[model samples]
Target: MTVLEQTGRRPAALAGLWGGLALTSGVALTATSGWLIVRAAERPVILTLLTAIVGVRAFGMARPLFRHLERLRSHDSALADLATARTEVYAALIPLTPARLGRRSRSAVLAGVVDDLTDVVESHVRVRVPVLSAGVAALFAILLTGALEPGAGVLVATWSALVVLLARWGLALEREAQPLLGAARAEVSRAAELVARHTPRLQAIGAAGDVLTRLDAAHTGLARALRTQSRGRALVTGGVLVLTGVTTVVMAVIAGRAELPSAVTALLVVVPAALADTVLPFADAVRAQARAEQSRAGVETLLDQTAAVADVGRGRQSSTAPHLRLEGVSAGWVEGRVDVGPVDLDLAPGRRVGVVGANGSGKSTLLAVLARALDPASGRYLVDGRDVTELAADAVRELLAVVDDEPHVFAADLRANLALAQPDASDQDLVDALRVCGLESWFDALPDGLGTRIGSGGRGVSGGERARLALTRAVLSRRPVILLDEPVAHLDHATATSVMRDVWAATSGRTVVVVSHRHEGLDAVDQVIDLTPTRKD
Candidate 1:
């Protein structure tokens, strides 16, 4: 089910019911207390005042009790919806990974999805409950006041109608600001992640200052967007208070000229002020309503995209790696544009090929096509002499393992991290894979051996070590075909050569296709294809 489809509507509706009761209780408390004060001051009989005092007590206690129940139900519903949305969105994104996520890093894309989903689910409590609660309480106030004094009732109804209009205006302002705020926040996040992930590279190239300047600019834009958003909320909340003051004044005049009892007149005067409390929360609801709309649009835009590669093809199974060939194959991330081109290549089993290209030469694009993450736009890609389009993409992908420049290390122990590639492998098998990836010495030196914690909060890893760890996983997979896309790009010359040496040794009998702009690892490959673009002029 889509995220919007599982919004826990029933629970939110129940919460709104409870919330309405709580707000109505609060309004009743205010009106009753006012009535009791006025009636007691008139020196009424003690028994008459006793009932008013008891009513005041009852409503005061009911407000808190109902409010507590409302909170419990509303929050529970939001949490339940959030859980389902996260699970479904994650599952839906799996097929689109690496290719359909656009040019953003996977971490950034996933982070955006997480934040958007939270916003969408939060609407149940922030938007639905508040609007429904206010609506119910306002309707009750209008009826009660109209019964006692029709003129006062008209004033209350007008005030409520104006409040609804004001909420619509507030929502429009919020919608205007949301896009700016979202873009600014995303820029801040992107800039921050770049600095955090590539601090050493930035410092090494003396570009740290420039990047920091860009980060500062991003923050400035975010602060500006926040100010813009706050202005809208301020206008809305301030308008609610001003309207309440006017309504209360008009209500007093109506009650004063009416033929009602002193106690009833006081109740009419206090009604508008009491309802103000409930209406004030609408400002927050307006903002949330606007935010949820934008978030849902973003998520739908992403999830609704047709995948770059087709899924329905003949279900051909392969017992071993098939001979792959790209006959004048070309592909691109966008339609009507070719990023990489008219290249010819052949990969018989166990043959190692290297693709060398300058930046923008589409080396990665070709590798994506080879890995079945992307479909060729023109020409043919063949597996075992059969057109690749005729075979299931997943079946073709099963024989290959890809290691890219950016390999993530989970916050886990050494054994757990490496074991994901081969879940049933023993400790000895893990150690062997580490040895094959040239990480045996590093493993032995670890403080806790295979038990050592790594990533985020644990022991830090050098770039070379991180690359080797990824290699270890690829080696352990035993997929028969390895595709390395600049796996050692971030490492220094010596480390890159050493890692490539281990890579060659570990995959001796496996077909390998390595793409890199650098010459550090190409010597080990059987053949190299250079794709330096020529100037048309």
Candidate 2:
């Protein structure tokens, strides 16, 4: 369903208010126009006063229209709200992430958000403007027929018919774009994600150029589709408008020659032109609604996917690691390679546990289970003897701060990195965490201290440095548990050992689980959980 339909309150409100106000204004304008035409015959000076009054009132009304549009379009708060919802939806879908988004889906979303959503905003305004303006024009035209002559009602009806036809065309266009745009957006976004995750691999294989070429081509395809749609609409509108203009001209000619009162003649002539102008806006409204529908689908689809995992995690909180247990947990990768546990394990707070496994072993997955990143296909995972499977997701997330092997660094500055754990963190806390990560030396060399950009893919920083930064982020998060996929994977012996020591010491009071093939760096853990072949088999 469209967002407007979902709300159910806004459409009627917007249509009723805008259309009613417009209709009311039209009645007022028609009365004034009739009066002006009548007076213009006997009191020629009255025409000047009437014209001045109309001009001022019309000018004054523009502000309300503009203000209403301002609320609907490009409001900073509205944009921010949309952005947040987008982020939330994105976060929720991290679990069921498909391998790749389809091509058609990608185009749909890009078309929807950047194009369709924007159109919806414009459509809303167009819908209102035309409704208001046409109502006013029609009122005047109808009034003029009785007071002035019969041609006015006929002219008004013709204008309304033209409007109805165009509005129908616009709605049709949007409805068609909805699914196509949805599919395209999903594809494009998925492609973007693929590039982002595999940039290093792409570069290693000298394939970045090729990838970009593909993305560019896809983008071009989306743009072409949008342009074609726009051109078709413009052509339809232009043709109708030509017809409308001809009708308007004919009305003016009849008004001039007719023997009706001057007031009536003026009303008959001017009403068609105003009515035509009002109806034309419906074209824009139709296009806008189409765009909104697609944008709404992109966002709402993402939103609708609020992970059952997040919901499942929303039940309990616990204090210790051993209090955390895994019971018969079985899950698949890429859809069916059952990897670990119908094996049991328990951990307690302040315990340091190491998970060592060969490549493709379930070590990383085990850590995720403990960290509450993945929900097991079946079996129970518990926190503090309470089914963590039942705990609130936010609570579970807050409790475990994970730094996986492929840690994701935000596109933010050095200090901002550690501060994400606690947005309101004091300078001292940041310093303390960085010191514990052995990153004080790196921080000291930066010109901007805490404000240097990390660049894309941590381009400005080394892998080891990025790893340390991730650890720092977790430490700053100040959670009860820390899950490290492989905290010291690529560091030199001394650096790796030191980073491990510092990390272990900083997280001394929390539950720590490190998944690694090599174990030299994490001797501080209380116990090691090995998912290595011999141990598991």
Candidate 3:
């Protein structure tokens, strides 16, 4: 089903109603004004002209009034649909988070989803309202002119068909250009994000020039696609104006031959000009339709995958620190590509295990499975000797706290950011958690301490600090199992070792699983599991 169809029908209908009224009023005003002017030129008696004068005045007033109402209704409906679409899409993505999203650069994928949703929802206002309004006004014109003179009616009908044909051609062009446009946009986004987040590092490593070159290339491609798309709209716009001119001349000639009344002839001549406003917007509507179609396809593709795991039942909660085990557990981010495991492991309470593997050997994948962010494709992942697949996913998640390399620092007070891990935590508890994560010096340096606002728009956080902040949150959660997925990956060797030291010191009594390719932190763990896959020749 189309994305527009998924947004409820009532708002769309109301928008159409308002838009149609506005367009109809404008056409009527133009036609009546033309008739009034012609009748006045004939020196009609004042009394005889009263009705036409009153019609012209009423139509003129109604035009703006209806247009104002149309604007309000259309925008309100679009915003409402946007709100609903965002909520529904977010809910649908919860189960697919991190795994189906992508192995890396999940934020970029999510950002694309947001853009697509906006495009799809915006179609209600941009495409549907305009098309519906034009359709209604054109129908009114056809019926009115047909009653006055069948020849004029035929001329208008033929002109309308040509306009529709033009719009269709424009839509085809826009559709053909959409994929290229979308790719260009994605490249721009990826490049911009990379530069923004790592500008200093890129420059320090002397790779800044290469990244900027890529950004320039992406922008150039985007410009070319936009130019191609604009040609379609230009064709439609020029065609509509040209057609309107031809139709007006044809109507005037036909009216003269029919021996129509002067006022009627004037109305017939002016009708095409009035209809130009309605027809011109069809170019924009066609372009919007093409964009909406592409965006809808993207949203559908992302949401089509089945959830990684099912919530079978609420399941029994673990009493104290429960035993977790992975027995020959094989899993993959994508189907039919098992990237990790066909092995055995056990996690007793308070056990500290480290996972080490080369790139693509699936260190993070194993951690994701353990953290309940992913489900195993084969074999059993048991919690307290029972298969976790039979239990509620949320219940399994509740027992674990995850600290990944990239942890988001929300745009709020320092207290609120840390409080996400433990909402009921006191200020002292928060401070202690930071101290344990080796952020004590940084916390002390903060001007507002716990009240400091630090995120996108607030105080900047260094990479090491961000990693420590994540560790602080994990420490505060007090979950039985703390899964660290390369939490210190971004830090230098010395800092990584220092952070790992504090991590081990902070979570001394919990079941900790640290996944890392670096050897800096592995020495502190009780056991190290090497995930290097054995190849059979």
* Highest-lDDT candidate: 1
| Span of 10 residues, lowest total lDDT, candidate 1 | 1-10
Alpha-carbon deviation at 327 in model 2, angstroms: 2.8
Q: What TM-score do all the candidates reach, one by one?
A: 0.89, 0.72, 0.89
Residues 16-118, model 3: lDDT tens digits: 7777878888898899889989889999789988998898888888878877887888788788888878887888888888788864467767788888888
Clashing pairs in 1: none
| Model 1 whole-model lDDT (C-alpha atoms) | 0.90
lDDT of model 3, residue 159: 89
- Model 2 alpha-carbon drift over 4 Å, by segment: 1-147, 181-220, 253-258, 261-267, 310-322, 333-340, 356-364, 390-395, 405-417, 445-462, 486-498, 516-537
Better lDDT candidate (1, 2):
1
Residue 114, model 3, lDDT: 86
After the best TM-score superposition of candidate 2, give how far the Cα of residue 508 lies from its true spot, in angstroms.
2.6
Against the hidden true structure, what lDDT does model 3 obtain?
Answer: 0.87
User: Candidate 1, residues 346-395: lDDT per residue as tens digits?
Assistant: 99999999999899999999999999988899999998988877888888
